[model samples]
Target: MTATAPDQDIALAGILRAQHGVISWRQARRRLTGSAVNHRVVSGRWQRVHLGVYLAYPGQVTRIQRWWIASLAVGNGRPALLAGLTALRLHGLRLPEAAEPVHLLLPAHRTDRDPPPGVVVHRTRRLSRADARLDMSPPCTTAARSMVDAAQWAFDDTTAVSIVAATFQQRLVVLDQVRTVLGTSRRLRRRPVIESAVADAGGGSESAYEIEFLRLCRLAGLPRPSRQSVRRDRSGRRRYRDVYFDPWRVQVEIDGSQHMETRGWYADMRSGNEIAISGVRLLRFPGWAVRHRPGEVIADVRAALEAAGWHGPSLSAGSGSATASHDGRVPHRTRPILPG
Candidate 1:
């Protein structure tokens, strides 16, 4: 049957709209003649992004478009879901802006001899229907699975730990979901580190700095402090202390880069004054000190605890609390600061 020019244009627009302005060569061939497709490319109406993928529009490619391009370029009639850090970003995890390649996951048996530029291909035998969010546009691994894969695929142990912690801290996925994913994948790389990060995250260490502080406390054999514990100020407003030694009436606040700003500095000073007036000792450490000058941080924290009458490491400090679970399991103290 012969179709009118308007009909063809309408069909092409529909395909582009559904796929974020990306069309595979096969898709284009179905609706366009060979010459027609070539002419569009020659005229700059369509741009070739990958081997057989085309960007139907002319401007710079958006993130969503990049997802579609990666999916179509390597999918080839099989699953090519976004995984790892790429999927985590789509699920609302805040990450630094960098030229990171799109990470795509395919079945273990599928192989692409020539992967597209700016795209990283990963093949896995463990993928299942349950691991994918099929309803999402340019289908991706579920948040939990994506986080697990991200941690496994990270460049180093530190980066891997940060990925897991940030995922939980940002509330991209709940602890249960991550645990479930981890249970299903037994052979994942960096499993131990990932589990440790999860435990810390569940214990209310909401940032990398807080996680490091917890490790330092353990290294120095200090009593574990309850994290993100709630307390009322003079005005009766509830505040979440970063780390609190409840038995000794001491608090430790880890200040990230944000605390260096004018507003943050003023707010922190006000909070410190309030803590002092309440007769509880307060210790503050910049984020860099926790990472770089661990010895100094440990000394100051120990001094504060000793002055507050902490005789030695005592289980009573946080024995049954979120911070100190005897079985190495974290209590349900983590609450999402941001909506997932």
Candidate 2:
């Protein structure tokens, strides 16, 4: 019935600006002309996230949600892109899991500034241009920067693999981009372990699984395999391999149910059969073998190598079924697959 107060509009806009959506009654009244404690108390619309922060949900807070929060938190707009686990997640990289203390970036001068609760701000005088590549998203880092950062900054193998896996999962990133970013990353010198990890990077079977497999091979100390290889036999027939060991004339296939496609299954078989005639030994392993049962898989590989005249040490055994000397999750259904 009353003409409503003016401060109420200003208060609402301020609340929206912060992205917290929820505002304290006292603060609302102080900032907004028409805002009143009684108004919010009477209205059932506000949802509380903390003592002061409110969120509108059933509607979720995405990166946009965080950006809105960041923008309002520091309206001046300094040089910060969400860094650490936050950036890694935004880039869709697979990490061991995730860490707390949402990371942030602020300029060098602000490095020592006290930040709002629940955010960790990293200070950098200069951020890599690559970090600004994907404007279409947010103030997030480029895919390659994200991957490089993950490889260098991740807590462990699981974390690094997850980040790289996530990077590839979001097909927006190309291999060339990853190579370009890594080629000049300053963090490169700080992370030698990461170099070995990236050396084996490959594409195919788009998921965290393959990334973990790459990490596993690195852990097992196996030679890095060539990705998406193409070779021809005497008849000029082309063959494709997920991974190729050119030195050993061997091809390792990491198969998941996805690869066993109705059409792909037959096509792969036809191509594989042809490659067999060219004197290349074909070795296929299931996704599970690389994951839960890597030891057995590793041993089987060593044995296969020995059989192929690889003068390496005897292999260790755990989940291998190829030799019938060990128990396996999926009994080794693969054949010796001798070369032609």
Once fitted onto the true fold, the runs of candidate 1 whose alpha carbons sit more than 4 angstroms away are: 1-12, 33-35, 77-79, 313-340
Candidate No. with top lDDT: 1
- Residues 5-80 of candidate 1 have per-residue lDDT tens digits of 8998899898888788888888888789989999999999999887778898899999898888888877862337
Per-residue alpha-carbon lDDT of model 2 for 1-340, expressed as tens digits? 5335565576567555554453433345455444444454447455443333344443566555655344234323232466655666666544455336556665567542334566655555556565663353335566566667655566675556555555665564666677677566564533544443444343453445555455455445466566767776667877567766678877778787766788978977877787687787887777766767766776676666666776642335643322322443223232211111
Q: Return the number of clashes found in candidate 2.
A: 16
Q: Pick the candidate with the highest TM-score.
A: 1
Clashes of 1: 0
